[model samples]
Every structure is written in C-alpha cells, then in structure tokens.
Target: MDRSAPPSPVSSYSARRGLFPENEPFAHGWLSTEGPHEIYYEECGAPSGKPCVILHGGPGGAINPTMRRFFDPAKWRMALFDQRGCGRSRPNASLEDNTTWTLIEDIERLRVHLGVEKWTVFGGSWGSTLALAYAIKHPDRVEALVLRGVFLLTEPELKWFYQGGAAMLFPDAWERFCAPIPPEERGDMMGAYHRRLTGADRKVQAEAAAAWSQWEGDTISIRGPEARPAKFNEIDFAVAFARIECHFFMNGGFFPEENWILNNIEAIRRIPGWIVQGRFDVVTPLASAWALKSAWPEAQFDIVWDAGHASTEPGIVDALVRATDEALRL
Candidate 1:
C-alpha cells in the first residue's frame, strides 16, 4: 500500500537529518535522575526557539528522531528522551527504577536540566498519559499540549487493551498469548506469563513476547498500516514487554480510577491543548477522547478517520503539526 506522504518539509528534513530534523542536533547526553538512574535525551533546533518537549510512548519505548517533525526547526526547539528504563535510559528493563511516578519526576528533572521555564508538550499513547500527568501536576510549567492517541490509563482502558474488548478483535493473537498457561492459571496472567516469559526457556520467552507484541501492533494500526511498527526480537521481547505490561497492570497504569483527569481538567484547561484521536482506535478508544472534549469543549479535539494509536498515522501526524502551529500562535 502507498502510505500517504508527510508534509514536504517533513520529508525533506527526514531525508537530511533523520526522521526529525537537520537544523541542529542537540548535543547527545544524559541527565542525572539525581538517583540510581540517569535519563538520556537529544535536543535539536535553535536554543532561542520556543521549547516544545516531545514524549515517546512505551515506558520502555525510546523517542525517535522522526518526532522532530511536529515543530519547525527554526521556530521550536525539540527535546526527546527515553523514560526511565526505556530507550537510552540506563539499565534496560530495570524494575527497580521504573514506574509512572518516576517518569513524572524525570520530566521535572528534564525541564530543570534544560533550564526552560515552560514549554509546549507533545506525546502519543503512553506519552499522552505522561503529558496529561505532567500538565496536571505542574500546569504552570506547560505552555500547551499536542496529544495524540490519548491513553487515559483508566481501568476500562487497561482491561480492554489487556483482555477485554480489544482482545476480541485479535483472537488468534490472544489465544497464543494465553496458551502457555492452563485455564486455571489464566486468571493470573502476570504471574504465569512472568514466570514463563522470563524463565530460562528461550522458546517459551520468545513465543510470549511475539504474542504480546502482535496484539499491540494490530491495535496500533486499527484503521490501516503503521509505517513503523515496533520490532520485538526474541531476546529483548520477553523481558521488556513483560516488564512494561506487568508494571502498568500491577500499578493500575500509575493513575487512579476512571476520569482520573476529569477533576483536574479545570486546572490545565486554561492552557491550550489538542486532542487527536483515531475514530477506530482500539488502543486508546475514541470514546475517552470524546469524554475529554466534553469536559473541556474548548479543547481542540480532532477525530482523525484514517488513523490509530501510532503517531505516524498520516492524519494523526498532520493534526499534531497543526496543533503545534496553533500553540505557537497562542
């Protein structure tokens, strides 16, 4: 299939500097978590340009240079980093220093490290969750938000993604993911999968990781195809996937019950924000996005018909670019 091409400037920059931009690459480095771990990140664009921080999904997924496309190199400086154990962050899959709260703190540390008073924020999927969490916690530090594939991290959202509605769409993948354990053990997915996927058996671990990732890929591109799907190999699959999933599950996605952000909307509403969601998004369903719009009708919410969880989705990407442009105006 011929995927829709991105904006000409986007494609041009991608070819020159990577998927992000060639204007100027941020010096490569790490920020002390001021704890056991250090967060790794890259910056680009002009130092004097308005700050627009980009957050990548996956507690374990690292930010890509491609993310730089959301902002104009001359107008906005971009900061991209790996959260805690994900991406360039030290000690991959180290449960000792990974969690939602730890990530929130890391963002704070990042802002301080960068010496930015406030900046527009951009994120998708899990990144969206982090953006919202950060915005609520420190609304003063957020200039605006460019959110795509909004993951609210509610129980319904979690259950659907894990073993409920979304699972029904991928029976084959679900069956494979669940096949390792017996019917009785099925109730304890975390325990059973953790034991087997992390066990010494290489075959057992690979199968589990593949099954887990297949479902995620399918959901990420609900309406169509994602240009870049995560590549999960046998060695990195089991431990990484298991760690992220089990962490979210055990901690209830690092947030409380449904409408966790509802009560706090009034606080962040004063800040300009955009909600870009796919109409058929199985990962972070459009329903939640709609609810968010209902709470803050003034918020810019675009329901892109031809997209899904992946930010690279044509419509989703365009919406983000537009959002960033609009935020700059405000």
Candidate 2:
C-alpha cells in the first residue's frame, strides 16, 4: 500500500459514506483469562475473510453492536471483545490486575484462541493507545492498523481534558463536571475524581462515576451533550466506564515512560496504518494525532474537518469505513 502522500480530509467531498448494514456475529463467547477476568468476544463478517481485531475506547468503553458495522461482512473477519471490566466481561468494573500489559496479553490470548496468526487492529481514543502498545510489543502479530481520535495518554493530553484546556471551550459542561468536586480539590481534578471513584463509600463511587462519565458524554461529539446516547448516563455503564477510565488515566496508562508509544515507533514503522482524527475533537484532540503522524510518517493520516471525538459522527464513520475497505488490499 502506497502512503507517500497524506490522504485528503474525509469531509472534503459531498458524497458521504456510511456504516455497513447491521450484522450479527457469526461466533460469540466468553474466554476465561489466566486471571479472574473473563473477556467477551464476538466474530463478525465473513468466516473466511481477512482477519481484523476491533478495540473499543475508554479503557472502560465496552464494545457496542454499532462497532461491527465499520467493516464489510463479505471482505473482513472482525473480532471485537470487551476489555476486562466493561461490556459483558465478568466481574464487572473490577480494577484488579487490569493494567495495559494485561489487556495486551488478553488480545494475544484471544488471537491464539481464535487461531489467527496476524490481523488488522482498529481502535480509537484509549483504544488507540492500547493498540499501539500491543503492536509495539508484538508487531509481528499486526497486519495493519486503523486508528481514530488518537490518544497517546500523555500528561499534557490528560491535563488538557481533565484539568482546564477543554473546560475553556465547554464551560457549561465543565461546571457540571466540577460540581462533584469541591473548590479545594478542583485543583487536582483527576486525583480528586480518582479518590471518589475508588473510594470505600458506594454512594461516593456512584456519584463520582456518574459525573465523570457524564462529562465525557457531554463533550465527546460535535452535536453536544443532548446528541450523546442515553446509554452514557445509565448507572451500570457509567460506573464501569468512569471507574476504569479514571483508573487508567491516574496510572499514566501503565507505560514505562511518558512518551512510550512515540519512543517506540520504530517497532511498527513498516506496517500499513491509517489515522482518522476529528478536527474539533476536544476529547483526544488533534495534537496527539499530529505528533503520532510525525513520528510514524509511513502511516496515512486523514483529518475530518467538521467532526469531533465520537466515532459515530458521519465524517468519522466515512473515514473509518474507507480505511478498513482500503486495508483489504493489505
């Protein structure tokens, strides 16, 4: 695949692409890992099609049925699994032994269990972070990568969204996000939220979880909070999503160093990859994607000018679907 020239912005053309029709998974089940966690996985698309693995965002974000629509059923065999504590995975919302490294191992376990030697990796947000870490660790197992809303889990990125940079743009939502924390604790927002998210009081944890998840739900898309799905506010989903996300963010993604992904870019330099980022994505933002493209020049980068962080946005859906279709050549 030639990636000498950067791809055009996904929103440039009048004709827009949409997700493939909804399809049922050909095979679905739970895999018990070495630890107490049991991962939920489902295979969609053709049984004999090109193998691909889809990684959902949030460190806590569970896989949804809509994610399976990104690939053509006739040409791609996509496998999607909920990370340790999210979705249908067992011991819901438990944080024990749920580091980035363990998740990487879970990917490998799933791969071997499925009898696939190599496959394409698709992820967005924190999913992109995990994909990069997994690819860096086992580049030989990755056939290609399709990433969106790139997040490298750096301190500046964390401070931007969690602290004040994003707040400058969404003061209304920011106020709501900060309402849960007192003025004294607001200075260290992540720390404050982490305390409450992981606190002994179930009420405190639930309150913190709702606030954390709601803030993200409120800001993730260009359409704003009202446009976000109602699932974002559900108590069960909010608890797992917020708790696990705060846990990962507080732990610095469990990377050995701050710029581990960029520092180790050489591991997958020759691999064919595409990065699709939203121009107005306050959640993950564009700087991280730019830095990633600069570091990995071989990968094609497509900026969606009118979109935000959510993968459900039309422009993002277009870019991702096109990227996956293009990956078929690989």
RMSD of each: 5.2, 2.8
The top-ranked prediction according to lDDT is: 2
List, residue by residue over 1-330, the lDDT tens digit for candidate 2: 222233567624567689999999999999998889999999999999999999999989899889999999988998999999998999999899999999999999999999999999999999999999999999999999999999999999999999999999999999999998999999999999999989899998899899899889989999877767677878999999999999999999999899999999999999999999988899999999999999999999998877899999988898899999999998
Runs of candidate 2 with Cα error greater than 4 angstroms are: 1-14
Cα lDDT, all candidates = 0.73, 0.92
lDDT of 1 by residue, 1-330 (tens): 112233354443333211234454756688887677888888888778899889987655667667887788888878888777666678765667577788889888888888999999999888888898899999999999988888777777766777557768767657766766788987656566666655788778667666666656666775443443645434474356566666765677667655678767887878888888877788789878878788877788788766667777666676677678788887
Candidate 1 structure lDDT: 0.73
TM-score of 1: 0.86
Best by TM-score: 2
- What is the Cα-based lDDT of residue 204 in candidate 1? 81
TM-score of 2: 0.96
